[model samples]
Target: MSQFLSAIIPNEKYYEKSAFEQENQKVFQESWYYIGLTSSLAEKNDFITTDIGGKSVVIQNIKGVIKAFHNVCTHRFNKIKTERAGNGSLTCPYHGWSYNQDGIPFGIPLKKEFQGLDKESLQTLCLPEFKVDFCGKFVFVNVSNSEVSLEEFLGESAIKLKEISIMIGRKIEYHEIPNKANWKIVVENTLEGYHITNVHPTTFFKQGFTLKSEVDFEVQGQHTNMTLHLAESHKDDKKRAKFHKLLANRPFQPEGFFHQLVFPNLSIGSLFGITVYIGSIKSVSPDESVFAYELYETNLGEGELLSDAISEVVKFSSIEFTRTTLAEDKEICENVQKGMEQSNATKGVLNSSEIRIWEFQKSYMNLINK
Candidate 1:
C-alpha cells in the first residue's frame, strides 16, 4: 500500500441527491447484499424482509427451498410483509392477495369482480422475484435481477465469507439503526480504524483496536479484509484466558479479530470467531441511511459448550461493547455528514492504514461512474 493516497470521490458526492440516486441504481441495485442468515428462515413460511438499494425484498422458505420476491401485493401494490422478519404466507393486508412460494398470486379475494383475468393473468400479477443465493449460512439478495451470480460478485472473498458463516452458532442481537448520514459516509467510516482512538476512545481504543496497532489488510477484487492482531497484553487477559480454558476441548475456536467488507456494503467481523457481527447500510435518501446489524456467537457442541453463567457474562459484555461502539460511530458519522455541508474541500488524503477506505472509494467510483 502507498504511504499516501488521494481520495477519488468528491466531498459533495457524499450528500448529493443525484449521487445517491445513481448509487442506488448502479452500485446497490446491481450488486449483491447480505440480508441475514439462512437459519433465520429455516421453517416453512419463515421469511425475512429487507430493503436493498431502493427495492423491498422478502426472502422466505417455501416447503424446503428458500425463495426471494418483491415484498408487495399485486392488487394495491402495498408491501406484502412490512416487518423485518416473520413467519407467514406472502399475503397482502391491503386486499388479501396471497402469493404462492414461486411468487405467483394464487389467492385473490373477490376474484370474479375482475374482468379478463385468467390463470396466466395471475402469473403476470406474481410478485416480482429477485435473485437469492447463499454462501454457507449467509444469505444475499440482489434486487436488480442482474445476471451476475453472487459467487461472481463476491469473487475470491467468498471463501472467507463462507468460513465466517460456518463459525456462527446463534444470533445474539440484531439492530436496524437510522443514521443521519449518507450511506457512503457510514460505509467509509468502517473501512478505516483511523478514528478508533477519537471516535471509540473508551471501547475500541482502550481495547488496543486502533490503526496504530498491528494489523493486516487484503484488498481482494471489490472486497477488503483487515485482521487486527491481538496484543501481547490482551492475549494474557485473565477473562479471555478463562473463557478459552472453558472451550479448550472444542475442535475449532475463533482466535482473532478480523473485519471483512463485501463491497458496496456488508461488514462482517468476529472476535476469535467466538463472537461475530455482520453490518450493512442502506440509503434512505441523500442525507439519511439505515444501519442494520446482526451479532452472533460461535456454535459449540454440548461437550465444548461453556457454562450458561460464563456464556451469559460474555454475551452481555459483547453486546454492551458493540452497542456502545456503534452509538459512538453513529454520532461521528452524522457529524461528518453535517460538516460536509459546510466544507469546500475537494480531495482528502489517506494514510497507508486507510488503504481499505481508498480501495472502497475506488470500487465505488468504478461502479458509480460505469
Candidate 2:
C-alpha cells in the first residue's frame, strides 16, 4: 500500500463496541431520526410508512399539517397502513379503528362499548414528538431526551443550508438506495475529498470540481463542518476568479467548498449550482443500510431542463454510481465487521487526517452511552 493509504488512521472503537447497537432503542428509535421530506406528504391524508430506527412509523399530512405516528393498530397491534404512502386517515386492516394525521383516534369500530374510554388519551399516544425539529428543505429528529430544538441541533450549519435552499423552487425529490453495510461506512466516504481524486476519478477531476489541498474541520455538539478550497490557492487566478465570480451570489465558504456531517447519519455538502444531502436508513437490524440521498440545484429553466437535471443526477447517484461505489463500500464494511470480530485491539490511532472521524465516533458514543 502507498504511504498515504497506510497513514490513514481509522477509528474503529464504536464499531467494535456493541453498546451502541444493543441500546440503540434509546439512542435511535426513541430519539428523532429523519423520516421523509415534508413535501412528499403535502396533501391531507397523504402518508408514508417507513422503518425508523427499527420501528415502523407512518408519517402523514393531516388537514394542513404534517404528522407522524406509530404504524401499529391500537387494538391488535398490527400495521394500520401498509402502503409506503397514500392519502387517507390510517385505518386498521384488523379493526376499523382510524387515526387522524396527528395520530389521534378519530374513529373506533365500536364507539358505544368504549364509551367511558378517554379518547383524548390518544394524544398521549402521538406518533412521537422529536425534541428537535426542522431547517428549511430538510428536517432533523431527535429520538432521545434531546433538550434542543431544530435550530439548536444544527447550530450555525442550518443557516448555510437554508441559504442554499433559497435557490431551489417548489418541492425536491429524494433518491435512496439500499446497501449491505453499516451506516457509518457511507458517512466516512463523504466526509473528506481525499477519495475524490481516485475513487471517483471520473467525476472528480474530469467533471466539474477543481479541488484544493487539506480539509478544515469544525465540531458543534454532535455535528461537524468541513471546508476545502476547490479552486486551489497556488493555481492561476483566471479559473479560480471565474469560479468564485459565478458562485459569488451564494454564501461563500472559506475556499470554494463547504460540507457538513451532522452526527450519526447525515452528510450535507454544497456545490456551485447544487447541494448534495446524503444519509443512511438502516433496517430494524443494523446489518442492512439504505443510502437516503438527494441533490438540489437552482431551478433555472422550466419545462424539460429542470426535469432533465433532476433525472440525470438521480440516475447517476442512485442508479449508476450507487451500485459500483456503494457495493465496494459495503463489502469493505462487512469485511471490517469480520475483522473486528477476530481482533481484540483495545486502542486505535487517530492521525491529523482522521481526527474528525475520531471526534465523530466520540460524539456518537457519548450520545448513546449517556
Candidate 3:
C-alpha cells in the first residue's frame, strides 16, 4: 500500500485563538511538562521556574528532595520567584511570607497585625503544589494533578528517556528562542526529517545526518520517536572518528541518534546518546511560542571530566551545530505560521517519510478533540 496520509488537523486549528485555548486547557495543562534538569538544582533551595499553559511553576531542591509548587504567592497571588532559575528560600518578596518544602506558610512577618488569623488559617494558606516526578535526573511537572504518573505518561518511551538521561551529564547550554509561529508548528517541524534536505542543508545535511529515507519511526503510546544512524558515505569520515574517540572511555556509548516527542510538548533528542537536547514547546498565543532547550554531554563519572581541550571542542561543537540547526527551524516554522492564516487549503498532505508528523497530529487531535 502507498504510505500517504492527510493532515488530520485543519489549517485553522494551527492559527486559531479558540483552538489554542482548547489545547492549553485540555492538552498542555493536563499533561506533564519537562521543565529542567535536576543537575541545575544541585543544592538545597535551588529552584527553576517555568510557565506552562499560563500557569507558573517552581521546582525546588529542599533538603535533598525535589518539590514543585505554583509560583504564585498565597497572600497576593504575585509570583514568588520571578526569575527563571535561582537558589533561594521559597519566600514571597511581596509580603515576606516564607513557605516550607510542603508549601505551607511557616513565616508570616507581622502575623499579629492581621485580625482573625490563627494557626489553622495559616496552615490552610499553603501554596498550591503540582505533582513532580523524574526519570533519571530529568524533572517533569504535572499541573493538572492527573492520576497518570510520569512513567505512565511516557509509556515505553520512558526506557529511552531514562537511558538518555543516564548517559548525559550536567547541562552545558540553555537557550530560549521566541518563535513567531504556533507552538504546534514549531513542534511538528521537529517530528519529521522531510525538511532536512531543504531547511537544514548546511547545518544538518552537510553533517552526515540521514534524510527521511534512512530515518526509522516508532510510535510509543501517544509519543512518536525517530532514530537515525550514520549514513554509509559518512561512516568512515575522520571528523566522525575523532568525535567518537573523544568519549571512547565513557561508560555508555550511543548506538545511534534519536529524537522523541513526549506527547504534548516535550522533545528529547540525542547525538549518539551523548550531547542530549531536551526542549519544551510552550504556547504563548495562537501564533507565538517559546522553544527553550538545554544541551548536555555524556556523563564521565566523578573526576573523569574530559580535558580542557576536549571539553572546549565539545562545547563549541554542541553549541554551534545546535544553534545553527534551531535557527533554521525557527525561520522555517515562522514562515509557515505566516502562511497558515492565508492558506486557502483546508489540510496539507503527508508522505510515508512524514509518518511521525501524522502520528503526532493524530495524538494532538485525539487530545484536543476530547
Candidate 4:
C-alpha cells in the first residue's frame, strides 16, 4: 500500500528519528545544491567559497567552466579557501597546497618532504569536485554525482528560468541570506499562497494583490512547484501603481509569469521583469538551517534614470518583499518548530491548500526513510 501520512506526521519534525524522518543523504546533501550566481563569477578564474551542510566549499570559473570543490586542505583537512570569493589560484594556508581553476594541484611549497610525488599525483591531490550546471546566471552544483540532469530535475521550472534569463540577459546580481529555521520551512513558505492572504496581508493587500488561502501543486521526481497566482484586488496593486509608469518607459510587460520550485526546496519565482531566486538550501537539523537568495533582472536602460528606477522600484520591491516575508516566515517556522517539539502525541493535518507542503514532506520522508 502507498504510505499515507496523517495528522501525526506534520506535527512531527521529519528529521526526528520518528515515523517521518528521511533516510536519503543522497536526497539532501550529495546532490545539486544551488551554489552561486553565474554573474558572481563572470570572468575566468573568478571564485567563491561558501558553506554547505556545514562544510566550506570553493567554486571557480575556469576558462568557460564552473567547478565546485570542498574547501578543506587535502593534507591537514583544514579549510582551503579563506575568502568568500575572489580571483586567484587557490592555496591552502594550512599546508601551502595550491590548485588552479581546473582543481589541478599546481604548487606545493615543500615538495622535498614528499619527494616521491609526481606532478600527476600532486595534480590529483586538489580538492574533490561536484557536478555543475546553470540556467541563466545561476549556478547549481550536485555534491554527489547524480544520474539525473539538472534540467530534468527542474521540470517546468527550467522553462520559466530560461524565460527570465532571456529577459534579464547576462546582467544581474546575487544576494544570499542564511536563516534560522529548517530549510524545509523556507521551502514551505515559498510553495504556497496561504501566508500571503494572512501573514502578508499588509504587504500584499497594501499593494492591492488579492491572495488566497488556497494553492496549486504539480510534482516531478523529488521536485515540485506550488504556484500562487495573485489577483486584481491585491493590496500591493495600488502601491504598485507606479509600476504602470514603466508603460511609458518600456513597450510591454515581459513575456512570462510563473513560479518554479525543485523539491527539497530550491525555488525561482518571476513576475513582470523581476525574477527572484531562493537558492539551494538545506536543513542542518530539525531546527537550524541556512539559505541563499538573489533578486535580479535585466538592466532597464543605460542612464541614471533607468538604473535608479530599476534599482529603486523593481529591485527594491522584489528584494524588500522577500526580505520581509522571509523574516516573517523565520519567526513562524521557529514557533512551528517549538510547537512540533512540544506535541509529539498528535500528527499535523494538511488541507488541500497545503498539498505542496504535504507533497514535499511525503517525498522527503520517502527518500530519507529508505
Candidate 5:
C-alpha cells in the first residue's frame, strides 16, 4: 500500500446515525442492487420482496419479463407483499387491493363504493416502478432513474461474475442473516484478507489461504477483485486428481478462488468446484444490517449413481464449510460494531494488507461527499 493511502477512515462513517442516513440516500438508493438469480423468479407471478435503503421493493416475473415496484399498495399505502417469496398475484393484505404481475392495478374491492372507477382509470394507479436488468442469470435493480446501465456500473467485474454465474448453473440455496453491525463494517470485513489468518484461521488459513506478500489488486470503477492462490502443497497430484474427478461432469471449471467486492455492499467469494457465495448487505439502520446470501453450485445434470453420490457428498461438504466460515465473519462484524460504538477514538489505522479496505473507504467517501 502507498503511504498516502494508509490512513484511518473516520469512525462516524461506521457508527454515526446521521452519517448512516446520508449513505442510505446517497449511496444505496442511487446505486444498482443485486437482488438474486434470474431463475429465482422463473414462473409467471413468482415474486420476491426486499428492501433497498429503507424503501420496500417487490420484484416479480410477468410473462417472462422481470418487473420491480414499490411494495406499497397505492390505495391504502399498506405493504403489497409481506412474505419473502411466493408465486401469486401481488395483493395488499390490508383491504384486498390487488395488482397484476406488471404492478398494474387490476382489482379494487367494493365496486359500488367507488362507482366511477374502472380498469382504464386504475391504469394510472400502477405501483411506482424501478429499473431492472440482468448480467447472465443474476438480476439487479436500481431505484433511482439514473441513466447509468447495470453493465456500466459493473464494468470489468461484470465479465468475471457472468463467467462464475454460468459455472454455478442456478441458485440452490438462499439464506439471510441479520447482523447487529453497520453495513460498512460487514463490507469492510470482506474486502481484505488481513483478518483471514486471525478471524478465519481454522477455516481459511488451515486450507492454505493467505494474504500474499505481493497481492494482485485491481480496481475498476467502484468494483475490486483480489485473487487468492492456494499453497503449492495443497495442489499436490493426489488432491488435484480428486478435484478434477469431482468436477469432471461440470460445464465450466473455475481457474481459482476469487474474492470480489461490488461497490457499496455486495461481496462474492467464488471457490472453484465448491460454491459461489454472494453476500449482499442491506442496511436497516446505523447499527443494523441484513446480509442476504445466495449459494450456487455447478450443474451436474443427470449422471450415473456413483457419480451422483460423489457429487452430493461434495456439495454437502461445501455448503457446511461455507456456513461455518460465514458464521465466523458474522460474529467478528458484530463485535466490531460494538467496539466502534464504545470507542472514543475518531479513526483507526490501516495496514498494507488492507489496501482493498482503503479503496472501499475512498469509494464510499467519494459517493457520500458528492
Candidate 6:
C-alpha cells in the first residue's frame, strides 16, 4: 500500500472512446444496475423503463411478480415505451401490437396480413428479459444472462444496504443531475473521504466530520464502508440529548454518519438518524454520466406538524449541502476529464487515504480486461 504509487488505470482510460466502449460492454452491460425503488412500481402492470449501456430495458410488476425485458418492439425493433414509469400493458407505438405483462405479444392489428402469426407463434416475438432482483424495496436489473445472482454479487453489502433502506423508511426525494465527466471519476471521488477536508471543508468537514482511521476501514468483497465520526469537541451534549429524545421512537437510531461504496457505481451516505442519501452513477459516454440521488427519511409518526417541519428542514438542508458538494466535485472531475483527454497528461499517484480508490480502479481494470 505505497502512497506514492501511480493510479492503477492510465489516464487514457478515463476519456478514451475505445476504453469507454469496452467498459460499456464488459462492466455496465455485464454487471447489475440499480433501478428505482420497488415502490415506484407498486401495482400490477406498473412498469419503469430505463437504459443500460444504451440498450433500453423495461421492468414491470405483473400479478405480483417482477419482470424485466428489452424495451424494443419485436416487429420493427422500435422502442415500445419511452416513459419513465407507467401502468398498463406494453403496446408498440409503431403498430398496434400489444404485449402482455410477461412480454408475450397478445394482439396485433391486420390479423389477416399475418396469416401464420397466432398467439402461439407470436411467443417467439416476446421481448428479451434480463435478470431482475430486489434488496428490500430497491430494484436491480442485470442485462447479462450470467448465473450469478444479484445477492451474490452484492455479498455482505446487500444486507447493509437493505438495513439502511429499511431504516430510512420511505423515499421522500429523487433527482438526477447530468455530469460532464466520466463515471469512474465520480465513483472514485466518492470512495474516499480524503477530499472532504479540502473539497468539502465548508459543507461536511466544517460540520465536525472526521474520516475514520485506516484501521477502521471495512472492506467486504467488492464493497467498502467508511465511518465518519463527529469530533468529540464539536458535540453538544444538550442538543444531542434533545435530538435523541425526538427520534427515540424511530426504527433506526443514528450514531454517526456512514459512507458505503458498492463497487463500480453506487454510493450511500447516511447521516446519523437524520437522513440517507443514495447515489447511482450511470455512464452516458466516454466523457458524460448521470448522477442520481435518492433521499430517504425515517417514519416520525403521522400528522405531527412540528416533527414534519423538522424533517422538511433537515431534508432541504441536506439537499442543498449535497448540491454544493457535488458542484465542487463535478468541477474537479470535469477538469480532470479535460486533462486526461490531452496527449501529454500522465497518471497520478494515490495517497494512503485513497486506498479505496485504488481498490476500485483495480476491480474495474480486472473486469474490463477479463
Residue 318's lDDT within candidate 4 is 66
Query: What are the C-alpha RMSDs, in order, of all predicted structures?
Result: 2.0, 5.2, 1.8, 4.3, 2.6, 2.6
**TM-scores, one per candidate:** 0.94, 0.75, 0.94, 0.81, 0.91, 0.91
Residue 286, model 4: Cα distance from true site in angstroms: 3.2
Q: What is the lDDT of residue 234 in candidate 6?
A: 62
lDDT, candidate 3, 1-370, per-residue tens = 3578889999998888899888888888888888788788889999999987788889999888899999999898988999999899999999889999889988988988989789788778898889988887678889995799888888898887777766776567889899989998999999887788788777667767766337778899889888776667776789777877778776455456678998888888887755788998889999999999888777665426666777777788889888999999999999999888898999998888888888888988898878
Candidate 5 error regions (>4 Å):
1-4, 118-120, 170-172, 211-214, 248-255, 300-307
Candidate 1 vs candidate 5: the TM-score winner is 1
lDDT of each: 0.82, 0.57, 0.83, 0.62, 0.79, 0.79
Superposition error at 266 for model 3 (Å): 1.4
Strongest candidate by lDDT: 3
Model 1, poorest ten-residue lDDT window? 247-256
Per-residue lDDT tens digits for candidate 5, residues 208-283, read: 7766423467888899988666666565558656766766766545445678888888888876545678778888
Error (Å) of candidate 1 at residue 171 is 1.9
For model 2, residues 195-281, the per-residue Cα lDDT tens digits are: 565555554444334445656787776777777654454445675467445444443334535677765566666544433444444
What overall lDDT, based on C-alpha atoms, would model 6 receive against the true structure?
0.79
| Cα error, candidate 4, residue 99 (Å) | 1.0
Per-residue lDDT tens digits of candidate 6, residues 1-370?
Answer: 6655578888888888999889888887888888878877889888888888778999988788898999999988999878878897778888978877678887888867987887688889889878898887778899987788988989988877777766765566788878899999888888777777778878877767655322246777777877766667666767766866777765545456677887778888877756788888888888999888888776654412236666776777777877888888888888878877875846778887777787788888888889
Give the residue spans of candidate 1 off by over 4 A. Answer: 232-235, 249-255, 301-305
